[model samples]
Target: MREIIAETNRLQLCVPTMDDLDGLSALWSDAETMRYIGSGVPWTREQVQERIERAIGFCADKGMTFWTVVEESTDTIIGQGGLVPISFNGDEIELGYRLGKDHWGKGYATEIARASAAYGFDALNLDRLVAVCYEQNLPSRAVLKKVGFRKLGQSDVYYGVHALLHECLPYDLVR
Candidate 1:
């Protein structure tokens, strides 16, 4: 097991491992869960394996990577999320998350996102964090807004689509 990264009342965030592939694949393969993500394509097992390899490498190199978000009480993995380094206009820390359909509307997204943002600011010492999502992803936009990310009036071509850009500072985080 990897070190625990964050915890909410009902969830725990920890470094992702190969063992997470089954749960992670199920989450990523769901069309509704991946609708706004890359290519809007449900990931295959091979793709998930590649992602796991990349995540492991990312953890090794950066000491931080996407975490497997799990329900503590049920010991079930409901999602994966984290702060990742990305090029939003040079180097920047980007907060990202994805949850299974069954986990939607449970406030788990907000809970994990808030925790992930805290780790970026408090643990990683990042002064600013950013996020990008499909313009139509209202739920994700709402989560970003709730976390104090402001719409930057900028758009970036990502995942073969234009995504709205958002930014937040350490002070902007909702404590």
Candidate 2:
């Protein structure tokens, strides 16, 4: 599995290791971050471990995963973001992230979303990448838009809240 250490102007992106358990578990267990996910139910330690295992498995299976987002200077994991395998119209790589509440409203979401999409296209050689955000998640929708992802359509899941489906294609990059 490839541990892609992506460097932005102020952030460093890397996969979660064993040492990240405490931070990530805490982040996911927080009520705010889990609001849109599972109806604000705090995730259990076992669930967190399962998620970590799945992310690491993505690296082994597809050479990519939802990596931790850190401020390069402080080396603090402010969030998690990456392109992981998913299925929508068919097999696709999806963009996902969970930022700490303290790090919200800083455009970090858009910054990393764009970078993750770029990595999927440039490094993974994928023609198109997709993302799904809960209908109520305006911030996530905005991030997808800012990153140049177009809303192809929506889906009626999680009791008709409408998961907005978006895509980033190679042709879009040529613009």
Give each model's whole-structure lDDT.
0.86, 0.78
Identify the leading candidate in terms of TM-score: 1
Q: Tell me each candidate's TM-score.
A: 0.94, 0.88
**N/CA/C clash count, model 2:** 0
lDDT per residue, candidate 1, 44-149, as tens digits? 9889889889888887888677788999989998988888787445678788999999989999889988999998889888899888988899999999999899
Candidate 1 residue spans exceeding 4 A from truth: 87-89
Candidate 2 residue lDDT tens string, 116-155:
7778888889898877888789999888887788898886
Candidate 1 lDDT score relative to the true structure = 0.86
